[model samples]
Target: MGSNAPLNVSAMVVNSLESSGIDHVFLVPGKLIYPLLDAIDNSPLIRGIVGAHETGSAFMADGYARASRKFGVCAGISGPGTMNFVPGMAAAHADRIPMLYIAGGISSHAEGKGAFQDATPGGIFESGVVRSLVTDIVELKNKENTQAEMRRAIEGLNWMRRAQSFISIPVDVQKQDVLPGQEVARQPYAHGEFNACEVPANRAALDALCDQYLFQSKRVAFLVGSRGNDAETAKLLLEVAEGFHIPVATTLSGKGAFPEQHALALGVYGFSSHSRAARVINSDELDVLVVFGSDLNQRDSMNWSRRLTGGKELFIFDDSFDSPAMGHISRQGIFSGISASFRLLAQKAADNPPGLPQALQRRKGWIAEINETPLYDHRFEQLGDRVSSGDEALYPGDVVKHLCRILPKDSNVVVDSGAHRIFMAHYWLSSGKGNYFSSSSLAPMGWAIAAGIGVKLAAPERPCVVVTGDGCMMMHGMEIQTAARYRVKVIYVVLNNAAHGAIHIDAIRSGSISEQFTKLPCHSWSAFASSIGVAARVVERIDELDGVLSEACQYDGPFLIEVITGVFPAPNRYYAEAEACP
Candidate 1:
């Protein structure tokens, strides 16, 4: 009974997180997890951030993971608290984010005894997480067994890259003792310590495919996705496009994958897409299409339009050969990393030059045609010009465009789901990798505020700006207090449109006259932010936008700028086209 124990099970768990390079832990405090909280508070290598809600905690972890390119950790209590994590975990799962979810369970003896908050752990998150483990109290009591289980959980996380892993510790087990010098073991995979893996490309096979399809084709295009949207991949893509006279288009999630300002870049494709990109992707003249990293989902592919890929010879480069996102159009699918595949292809092109003067001239013609033609509707163009003067209420697109010009090139922009997201997606220019973050697959509202806080915590030096709608902000506005508490310098740009803008737009598109239900009562978001000790401002005119944004950017702490924008239509011609078709 008097034996010397080096640490407790809770301490061992914390040690494992530290070894995995996780520096921040987002959690909601609970009595069941007091021991774990105490351990985290005592650890020098990790810091604990309390969230306003369990859902926010999970989203915060997701933000940290996406921004830092490291695994994020979030913990909560049993039952309701665990259930709150379902939506956020599902968002991470759908978007392929790595998150470590920890939860407290009822005492081992309370099993089948109708104990308080006695729901089964990990049951709610089974669909969202890759693996879930419920630790046995008896196993935790033994030092060797504890180490083995910890290693097993971490190994599962490492193997299942970009997926969530769940582990639940019973209240009784968390207090168990660990023997001296019983540290968790590290198992490094060939793909380094994290999810960034490089698969060797088959140079010969790639060259043959490129010569047959790319070099000989009359029209070729590249569709890039979030997976291969990094700077290294982007640079290689530009070279391939320029060398072979191809145009590049990206998914909404991959908006910043290629520089939008480049002449060869066609901007985003699918759902609320740029007119030029959609026209090129749907053109019958495009004989060859090379897709990289994107899943080619309905949102990104416009319900998998036959016009977009039916006649073209599709070449897909993804991490897995059996990706469900590839659809049925790919004639050739390569199971290789996007960067590695492109690198080999780029090298082969250099070795065997294909001098296609006609193709180059055609590509130049296409660019000039797009530049001369109006991309957006005439009504939207007029609104954009009027909003620039700040004489009337601000438009979401104008706000995003101004922010793009004002913020530093390296600023990390996190956008929440709403009609505003479409505006931001179309207008925000991303110059670097990981500079823009949004959850398009799941499209969860209120994600940006919490996720922005996590992004700031991960990259303290970089400016993290959150663009959210009024309705979206109200859902998780309390998280602003969490940011203030941690001194997270995130500028909250609240587009205060007094309605569920997306729902209103949907109703209008459906020819419904009764959209009053979507309207919301206006609130003073600036006053709310100031009450929470954050620097706040209300921007009523376009003239005030620049000065307010500049001041918020310069502020050393949390800041909120509420811009009163009336409900307006997004530049979404795809919705209209889909409605009219069939």
Candidate 2:
């Protein structure tokens, strides 16, 4: 038996998070989790952000993690509230973003009973349906070992695995007092305390893999992902790229991993890829393809295009590389940081410096020339006249162009999943100083709306922008109010093409499907933002974009720029791939 001094498990959990350096916790207030919420309220080191919906809350956590480079935290109750975390958590899992979802389950003794929201073995609602989506699920039924279990779970958030973690605490145990308050206040979790994490490959194997696949290759290319964004890793990556005379390209989620303006830079490859990047990666001269911190599962992988990896020797550095069929030099992920330890070993002899391939030189010049003007896809021949006229009355590119042109030097842009994201991804040029993040695979709509709030809260110094579309706004547009309530400064540029942009475009272009289901009422997002206390302006033309964005950039509080544009598809090859799927 333990000391019966007053110590609440909920209170200890909040303290543990604070000690772990988690400053914020997003949640939708629920009865079962009230104790934990109250604990957060009393804590001086942590804050509780009440969200409009659990899904939005989860996404805010995802955004927070991406912005701060720290694991995100969210809370919910079992059953319905827990259910809302699926799409958001799945998105994080797909993007390999680190996050933790804490849910309050029914009483420990209430197992198979008719407890309202029990998720236990024989409960009415078994939340384990999301087991595969999350990295780990822990149900805390034993009250005594709560602190130890909490530490283990928090430490589990290391370099790899996939998605967010689910921690279910029983209601009875949450309120129970089993130890002294002083003992409970102990720091159970710390940001870097658990540094001894498992590396994907042993040092010897990694070196050998690099020797045969990297150093021996005549032409090598680097494809970095989200994990390649850290300062040390990015610096090391640039050094390695220069050291090896390699051209560096990034996955969709890795836009800012390397300075895009560099001579050796190849922009994003995959769905919203640059012709230059697709060409570089798919070239016959390429002998090696090295990927970092990404599974390359999203459009970032061009729907796992065989041509992308067909004849090349592929090397990857991500803790979450689970794709068995694509093949690799090492089945396990190689840490991007390992470049530090292996750089000298893989260095080309100084006397025999490799010259840039003649073909690559031309392709690089070609890409730079293409980027000199506004990126216009020749594939969309139907809209050639409107595209040439520079009328965005149906094009979101104008808005992205204007925003990219005027955005502050240091800004954080969080893009939601939609046609608008494709525009932003395809056109936005990054300097490696600013931050860019998007949920790739399980791209739940409205993720950026809430995620923008989290980004603003996490990186308060930078100008935060959320680029979303009408379909996403309809999903969780009200989350802007959450930003407004906290006085969190963020710019939301909602591209209202009046429909689910991509679906509508694909359906209309395919001619095999009904476009009626893809169309939306084209609701006025500006009016909605004003109704909810977020200042907003509607942009219906290209001329109105520059100044509207300039003023929004200077605005201190949350602002929305609703650009009424068209669903002009990005020059993406996805439509063809999707058509071929059947």
List candidate 1 segments past 4 Å from native. Answer: 1-5, 121-144, 156-160, 187-196, 202-205, 216-218, 242-245, 320-322, 325-332, 349-391, 508-513
* lDDT, candidate 2, at 138: 73
Q: List the residue pairs that clash in candidate 1.
A: 390-542
Model 1, range 113-186, lDDT digits (tens) per residue?
A: 66777755323332233233211111233445778777766654431245456777777788877786777866
Candidate 2 lDDT, 1-582, residue by residue in tens: 134546688987887787767899999988888888888888898888989999999999988888876789999998888888888878887777778889998887777777777667677444567787777777777878877777666765644443457888988889986566444334435776564343334466555654565445356778877766654556666766655556778888778767777767778787777766777787766777777666666465776566677777777655544552334223455553443433432343222434424433544554455455322345542344331123547466656767887997578888998878878877787766538878766778899999988888888988888899889998899999999888889999988777787777667777656878888896888999999899999887788888898889788799999987766756566424633662
Model 2 off-target regions past 4 Å?
1-5, 108-113, 161-163, 181-217, 230-232, 321-394, 574-582
The backbone clash count of each candidate, in order, is 1, 4
Indicate the residue-level lDDT of 102 in model 1.
Answer: 79
TM-score of each: 0.89, 0.86
